[model samples]
Target chain A: MSPRGRRPAGSPDAREAILAAARTAFARDGYRTSLRGVARGAGVDPALVHHYFRDRAELFAEAVVASAAGTGAVDISERAQAISRLAPEELGEGIVRSFVGLWDGLGGDRFSAVIRAAMSNDESLAPFRDFIVTGILGNIMDKLAPDRPELRGQLIAGQLIGFGVVRWLARLDEVASLDIEEAVALIAPTIQRYATGELPSSAA
Target chain B: MSPRGRRPAGSPDAREAILAAARTAFARDGYRTSLRGVARGAGVDPALVHHYFRDRAELFAEAVVASAAGTGAVDISERAQAISRLAPEELGEGIVRSFVGLWDGLGGDRFSAVIRAAMSNDESLAPFRDFIVTGILGNIMDKLAPDRPELRGQLIAGQLIGFGVVRWLARLDEVASLDIEEAVALIAPTIQRYATGELPSSAA
Candidate 1:
């Protein structure tokens, strides 16, 4: 059911308020927290949340993206629409752009926090893991070569994700502060390698 | 100039006391918290801490790795040894073992707290960033083709590291509960592709 199926007294503003509150609450508490909790935090009725958001996933996504208010980075939820831009040669930068943009933009903290939490606590994200692997990362892989394209995409995705963890999450000075181009320069080659690298005999 | 160099009398368990205090202090106040304050918390003179540890880096690493009174994970200075095992293929599992063993073996909350704190704050991990990149990750790359190994290591490392963040820090469901073999099976291939895959033509 929608958290707020119809706008209450203060339509969009209240919805925005609930979304903002959901971002902070989700950022701090995660996706499992009750609608009541969000309502309380937003100073609205729990039903109001349902009216606006279809459910927690929708709310969570909105909160995840909305929380990432300022960073001009790419947003993953917005990725499907971006599929047209996914060329093989430009793949490395495209991969980096999506991830870097996500964190650099608005949802870095919430997204990382949620993802990190999901990694450790098996209860919350059990259902979504395969989807992420086969869906998002895999989708990128399918665009390349079946034999190695997915592996390559994963490699590229892996490194950029690591760079984000160090710079954005772990606050490693070199990574966190490294200029974008320098980082891209350093990171893109790996992406290029993964995007189109030959397999090791051992692996083959 | 060791914090333990000058132990004050009346603190017979000064060493243990210092570690306990350091963990609490770091968790509560993070890396910026004063060693003197930690000493005060442990009811010992700051000199006693200096006597045991050379400085905050030494202390943080110690505190970061602490297991219990007499048994911490391993000495902070000793962890540099883990870096030596970082081969291209071995990097992911090795780091996985290092961190998982540390936390699991210690069976304490200290490292998690430090990881959480360091992730959000850069200054807290100034000493570890290089260790993470050059010492640990780069060493692994050294085992690969030099031309693009760093990029490779970084990508694979990101996935593994992010996996850790998700499993350990974010406490995400599906990943955290994954058995070691299952995790390695799932994660290692991606790691391998990055380590030894052919360089994409665009990359060179």
Candidate 2:
């Protein structure tokens, strides 16, 4: 019923306002912020959210990328370009620093909500995860090693986020709370090993 | 009063039985299953689950380990001993198979409960994640090349679980429904690469 977003059903132009609002709400409040919150933030009625998003989950997927993009975090195509210039170790640091910096600067409140929602249920989380791994992580993967990038990228990608989960999300006493300096010293070497170590001799 | 269980407090042995029942019931019905379910399954009064576990979350930790031990799958210590003997690529499959074997067979119902509980929130999930990373994954790390085993192990551990998550939990279209052999074949190469691949020279 809001005047700013009365886009008719199936109209591409109309959904943009809803998406913008959804992203703002999600980034501000996190992925689990209610649809009503998003609608209110957008200045549109909650009905418009359903009209464009079909559900809260879809809106959440929109919000993660949008927030990532807005925060200037480096998972974007730009990160790949920057990553290309660094050594393997530097690359790992660049990736880690950028993500951690973004999350840190962004205030963990938003991220915690996103992570909690993502980890909330398998079904609720999958779409957002797929978009990241495929759209965002996949792009990073493409840049890791052009020859057999899939496997190698996957390895790097796994660690990139996995460490984040352990340190930031899980907050294990020793590993989670490590100062960035200590964390960098500890994990960077390990990542370096992962980035350039010799292949193990067997596949099975 | 049932002979199946002992006194509430100071009875270390009785707590273990309650834990065993909790694991089975949680696995069978997930969050929906109540303390009553655990108690009933254990053949003891509901008070005991609270007495020993403090609540479902505490019970969950005990249940998780007890169920795994109950299943006799992956025999953590034995697997720890054998890790060094394993070909690194094979490591992923072995871990995956161990997880799937437990979920699909012995603790299928119970592990599902554990997984569902993990989906809830950080407080309930942190210990579970830590146990897996510090316990299950850490055990495997011991088998890795010692130089950077923690990093390498973490990387491998994340990817393997990520793969399993896609294949099993999230059940994404591209990955979830694959035949076991096909899934293994598709995923193993990536796992192998991560377990032991030289880092790409970032084209700086």
Candidate 3:
């Protein structure tokens, strides 16, 4: 009705502008922010937002994934590359510090919204799994743990995602309120163990 | 109105019967199973179900918490006691095997229902945090990692709870179909690290 977006429907700028606005709104107001508000901010109609994204979850996934790519926030390949550079013994701390940095730095707000949306329900969670879990996390695991990478990768993802949920979404006071460096200091070793450690032998 | 649950409103038997029925229904049909169906199974009016619980989420919390107590599934105190008896080196495998057993045995069905219900929304997740996180996991951490117990306990809980969600609720085929022993074999060391491992030094 209001002449659509500034650019055409299929144009990259229109789509990118909507996503940029979505990223800002979601970061500012979290997963509960409305498409209408995002549309107004992007100077597009609410219908255009729906046209670009199948639903709120898809929009959110695209926005978070794009932000991660653009800023290299929680970018799996980069993290894996950095961790690979460390001595094998140092991988644990390296991984932990990087994870804490991604969630506690400038990208923290956006990543929190992504995590919150991922944990909100099954529909929202599916895209997160497809994009982040099988994509980013899988890539990291494959690079680090050659054996049982899928299982171990999932274990790492569970730990990190659960951490995000507890620390950010549920706002568990102690874990949530931790200083970023303190959290990195506390949680890194556990990540290290999961990343590269021997499982205990069974007592036959 | 059908004799009001074989005693009175405040009777333990009435409450127990209702919980038993709710547990059965939840196990059979999961979170989407209706309160009306639970009442029908319990041989009481739907109103009686309301008398005992504030809503679906509250009933689900009570049922799952009671199930954990009754079956000792995810009962942190019992797990801590069991782990304490093991050699420190064996603690990792010990915790993993026990956790695998609890979630993969017959109790797995009930526990899956609980996890699914817990993830359904915030209202449903509270009692899970209070009972399981604070009560069971906190006890385990106190017995094992006395320093920074809360963070470590939560990290462990996150890993395990996330495992449950991925394996059961989301039914990620590979993770879900894993043999109980195999899962224990793979996940134990990570748990052990969180339970009693050294945090990395933050190089100034």
User: Over the stretch A48-121, how does candidate 1's per-residue lDDT look in tens digits?
Assistant: 78887655655655665334333322345456336425776776666666566656655346555644554333
Reported per model, the fraction of native interface contacts reproduced equals 0.22, 0.12, 0.34
lDDT string for model 2 (B11-78, tens) is 65667677777666655565346778777776667777776654444455456644533543234434
User: Estimated TM-score per prediction?
Assistant: 0.55, 0.52, 0.61
Expressed as tens digits, the lDDT of each residue in B49-82 for candidate 1 is 8888865656766775343223454554444355
Write model 3 residue lDDT over A1-204, tens digit each, in one string.
236535555666778788889878876666667789998888876788989776665575567764643442334445545665677567667776777776666444555455445555555556556654544554466455555656656666666766766775555666777777777776666666666665435311
Q: Alpha-carbon error at B100 in model 3, in Å? A: 1.9
Off by over 4 Å in 2: A1-62, A65-81, A84-89, A107-110, A189-204, B1-62, B65-116, B126-204
By DockQ thresholds, what CAPRI class is model 1? incorrect
Error of 1 at A45 (Å): 23
Q: What is the C-alpha lDDT of each candidate?
A: 0.57, 0.53, 0.64
Q: How many Å off is the CA of B52 in candidate 1?
A: 4.7
Best by lDDT: 3
Better of 2 and 3 by TM-score: 3
| Residue A112 of model 3, lDDT score | 48
Error of 2 at A41 (Å): 15
Poorest lDDT segment (10 consecutive residues) of candidate 2 chain B: B195-204
* Alpha-carbon DockQ of candidate 2: 0.13
Model 1 DockQ reads: 0.19
